[model samples]
Target: MKRILKRRVLIPVFIIVFGLIQFKTIDKVNMVVPAEFGILTIETPPKEVGELISAACFDCHSNTTKYPWYSNIAPVSWWMKKHVEKGREKLNFSKWSDYSEEKRDSLRLKSAELIEKKWMPIISYKIIHPEAQLDEDQRELLISWMKK
Candidate 1:
């Protein structure tokens, strides 16, 4: 009787708490990306290379993030927002044209090193986004472009 009573009380409490938390939501707005500021518009890489970057890098590193369905949830939304903010702070590809030539060169070299070591498109991201999972050939192509 005591165990039955505990489950009855706990389940309702848990559901109520979960429902209440949903009130806190992350902003899902994707600001319009101007052609002048976009990396693809400025750099003009080959189609394959551009596609790879879009799949693996753009969501977090660019201003226009394509938020996933889970991002609508409370705790997950909060975490994803923080992750994207951190990524953009490191490098905002949407502001590529704003960077100086020297800075761009330095960023390219660093990007190559990070990709070569499989440190980018982080494991957690790749797990959910299979399209962002770059095979060896795809990784090589991206790394070569960044090295250039």
Candidate 2:
């Protein structure tokens, strides 16, 4: 009797886990920055700085997010959505041209300050995206670009 009970519980648990794993959802990957949205018509910040920012920050802060395959899973996907929404609220690089001159200046200053304090990338992000890790020189380059 005890063996039968254990089998019943294990079978259902395994099925549930398997079912959860099979469930999938589509990620929102259509992130087109408007033509009039950026300060640079030809892509700003030079190649290196632009690459760094895109890798480290654009996932949440810009319209063009490159979603990974795992982003379609539960719990993780929910968290990703929330983080992206919050990041956009704080500063949406894809909407930069919509900001007033004063607001843009303030955001640029804040971006520099955040980079100097090692606070912009958010530690959780760098853990998974090792390429997003900015060395001291990269950080300096970003700061210089932001200030300009």
The Cα error of candidate 1 at residue 95, in Å, is 0.8
Model 2 misplacement above 4 A: 1-31, 39-43
Tens digits of lDDT, candidate 1, 85-132: 999888989999889999999988999998989899888999999999
Candidate 1's TM-score: 0.92
**Candidate 1 lDDT score relative to the true structure:** 0.91
Each prediction's whole-model lDDT (CA): 0.91, 0.80
Look at candidate 1 and give me any clashing residue pairs.
none
Cand. 2 TM to true fold: 0.79
Worst 10 residues of 1 by lDDT: 27-36
The number of the candidate with the highest TM-score is 1
**After superposing candidate 1, which stretches have Cα over 4 Å from the reference?**
none
